[model samples]
Target: MTTFRASGPPPAADPAVVVVTDLIVFAKHLRLLDAARLRGVTPLFVFGPETAGRDLARHRADPDHPLSRVPDGDVVHVPDTSLETLLRGVAPWLRERRVRAVLNVGEVFVEAAGALAQSLGLPGPGTHAAQVCRNKLLQRLAAPALAPRWTVLGADRAGDAERFGAYPAVLKPASRMSSSGVRAVAGPADVVPLLPEYGPGELVLLEERITGREYSVESLVRDGVVLWAGITAKDTNEADTAFFTETGHTSPAPHLTPAQEALLLDANSAFLGAVRFGTGMSHTEFRLTGGDRVVLMEAAARPPGDAITRLWRLATGMDQDAALLDLALGTDPVTAPPRRRARQVYLDHPRGLLTDVRADDVPVHWVGERGRWPDLPPAAADAPSRGHAVLVSRSRGDLLGDQADSRGRSVSVVLDGPLGADLDAVARDAARAVTISAVPLTPAGRTGEAVR
Candidate 1:
């Protein structure tokens, strides 16, 4: 079911931009509207059919939410998933409002946003580019020079895995997000059993797993030119696990030689052009191999998720959300060099019921202001971090390496210090100071058993 909130004051006769958001709306998206309003742009928002009610409720409940302040007439709900349907429903409304630009704030709306922009003759990556960015197989094929060798296989084609001649290959859905159903398989036996998890008509991809440090290149592209690029250091689940959950990230990736930086820029540029990404912000992830080789993993036409937009502002004084808004409105983005380094470490915990958390020794600000946390469900394969801490450090060295373990992280600490400070040691010390205690769940048959 879908709902629209156009109960507030009427919007300007003509708005400057339209932002189409998906089911998984992020807080930054709301902030984008607020920033545009601050800049005298009357922004209109179109929500997807599957847009979460909880998200909308949260926004409406929060007095500071941009939606609460924006004109009621600016909010619209489009209950359609098909690009043609969405375009047809929204095109007339946009034309009536005279919106100058369109912004796709989430993955679900990328293709639709592109189609709508093209229909309106606005600046955007065309539908073809947006479609390529959404599908992993297409992204790899578009940039063969930078992507790892990969092949598309049917659900019943496990025997064909031998063609890759690789043991530790990655198998993933071609078009899923949030690393769902993405697994690193060691052998054909492992690959065959996992294939059935995908739907009958869905295609799966088997690709060589590039072993190296992982990083993401974030850029603002204008007219096919990259205006500014930033490198983010990434930490994922432990190497031995099949789960590829992202655990942490640091901006301005601590130490990158000039050659490595150039390689990332060159590869990113090539990949974006190959996909025909023309404008707006781009988030492209790559793996840096032992020989300084850069291999593309994936690219998205929209801004990055997982608090990257907030980190960029803290670390580099760049408001990526606002910059993307400006790009959508045909304005040049204003960017600045890093004034401080920022790091976000996710909290993980083991499988259990109620949990106790201790963070008395960690010297950092927690993301959510809470004195005590509620009990969490038993940790599943897709267990998300409880919360994270934001740290601003003067020294890049202070933030390095993976601080959380596979057992599960539950707390993140942020800190800031001088240029030569040991952020790594600080993070380790913070991790040591914080501990998550959970009582393990009993076996399936022991439902009546008492707590030990």
Candidate 2:
């Protein structure tokens, strides 16, 4: 008997990273993508949702849109008029270029892009599987133990009073990402009537409300193997609890022992496998109460939004964007064991109109009015609204602390530690307080520098 070894040639393009961003320009994310491109991989950008969101028909450009600043050569921009259209447009390009893997960068663009690539016969997840993850109602249709309680109702009908949760239940938008319109409904008054009005254009997923701590698990897939992963506990701000504005988070599995971590990770892994996640990024958010009671909120086929990617990177010393880029490039990010402890990530939750900004009171570097920060707001104190100018903060405390500062009634920060809150009440208040209105400003101000 003889032992023989087969060898092939060296590798080609580093796994190609495909990110879907609603184009405006000057977005910090471009920097993240740029870093990956420099490290052997190519960065491709997918721009979607032509009219900001579903509600707005008027087109307003995001001054800080990542591409405005990033070099065009480094990115491949695929304009999105509609999800279906965007995919068909990009399919030929991906095929011609021979893309290795696709990184669904945002909630809005993930399923459509993944589906389109697969349909084009590209190596990626099929459209139906992406639908399972993107549609809240569909994701809830898991195995009995896996599926959440309650039913997936049409947004157009009246939610039956009897079928509603005995206690308060949560409502999910059909294709929502982030805390984008996640609501808590107590009984018929809240759940039933929503069907005729709120549920019409959208598919509503009604889930039994589970009282417990909220945590997010971030994981990356490589050649079908779950190579690197971590879990973080979500700590929210009490003062500006409305809108479920994310306030704080801690890494290395906060308050969760080895057993709890294992359970949640297992849940996430199962959820991913069930949905047929062959490649790309997967992030899951769940509620963990005592006695092994868990309610799965969602599992997305995209990078974790709201700066959590930065948190995972800070804690693990792994540039998530880079890793994602590597995944798309077909190269796995080599993890360097582990080191730092107690590292956390945070972002600010804003209220009212965001007019003027002064960071360290030094005239706010690289930020201006108009173009999203459009010329700041009229300097009128005492008459401020709620949930206006949301700024991103690094520390956990500072992000949530901005709520009490009357000087910043319109602004809020996201940080760590704790803000004791009645999450249910906060959710309702936020829904009533903020309806996702715009600040009527852009990133570019009177001056040349662009503001975020």
Candidate 3:
């Protein structure tokens, strides 16, 4: 069952941008809201039940919550985020307000949001690009030249996983995010058992694992032209032994040679061209093989998640949020040269019940702000010359699962330093600065002392 609820008064005649997204995490996405307000555009947020239910209720109850900054008419909660439902639910807003664009912030609903934008003759990535971006199989099919060797198994024929005969391969869902259900399989034996874990009637892809360094290229496009692209070096939890869960990221990737960086940029440009991406931001992941061969793992028609945008801002002094808004408003995006290095590392913790997590002793200056966001730096000359901060995702009493995927991880630390500084050392020091405590559970349901 789906429900659409639009409360409060009707919106004003000012130009508005409809943002199709899920939960609102201020720590990561406050720049988006700040950007809209700074640009004099009203933001109309369309949320699904997953966000609208508990999270929305909590935000509405708390007067200090960031959602309180937004007008009540601008927040529309729908039971489902399907395209038909969004169009119907948003029709009234479009009729009442002067809507100029529709932007997508969540990976799962990119296609629906693009279609919504197109239906109203607004700027967007378009359905074709969004569709290709959403489905891994479609991405592989559309750009075979850029992808690694791969094969697909339809929901009806998923039992034939072993038929591919590919060893040391990667098994991933056709349409999922956050590295969920993405695993590195050694052989057919490892592949068969995982088949039952997938949802019934879900498409899966098995591909030859391209070995080497992993990185992501984030670009802002306007009228099919890429205004700028930033490369972010990525590291995964290889010790987990199965899933490719990202653990760290460094923007303006430190060690890439000129030639290697050029190859990655060209491949990213080729991918954007192949998909015929019209406008907005793109986050594309790639694996650089032995001979500098760039293989596309996947791409999303949205800003890179996990505070990578913050890294970019600290590294290059570019306001990616404002750049994204510029593209949505049918204008060219602004760019800046790299001036520093920024890194984000997710800390490791034991599997048990989380008791305490803190980095209070670390002299860290966290990026992003709630108030005076429009006046915050890069724009300000006195922006912190060096910065570091910690973010804890899980709360006390939360049961911590094995690090099989991104959701299993609990906390992360972000650091900023000079361009020539050792990012590796900076990352290591940041990790050691934090402290976590978890109480392990015994097989017979007994709880052990808190382990720090």
* Predictions: Cα RMSD each: 8.8, 10.9, 4.7
Candidate 1 residue 218 Cα shift, in angstroms, is: 0.1
TM-score, cand. 2: 0.68
List, residue by residue over 46-86, the lDDT tens digit for candidate 3.
87755637657566566765677787788888878688888
Please say which candidate is ahead in lDDT: 2 or 3: 3
Per-residue C-alpha lDDT of model 2 across residues 345-400, encoded as one tens digit per residue: 23233432433434331122221122122112221222222222234222212222
Q: Which stretches of candidate 3 lie over 4 Å from their true place?
A: 1-12, 24-27, 155-159, 363-387, 443-452
Q: Model 3 residue 183 lDDT? A: 89
Error of 1 at 123 (Å): 1.5
Better of 1 and 3 by TM-score: 3
Which candidate comes out best when scored by lDDT? 3
Please name the candidate that would achieve the greatest TM-score relative to the true structure.
Answer: 3
Candidates by lDDT, descending order: 3, 1, 2
Please give the RMSD of candidate 1 to the true structure.
8.8
Give all TM-scores, in the order shown: 0.81, 0.68, 0.90
Question: Which portions of model 2 miss their true places by more than 4 Å?
Answer: 1-18, 23-28, 31-36, 39-42, 50-84, 91-98, 119-126, 154-156, 192-199, 237-243, 336-338, 341-351, 359-452
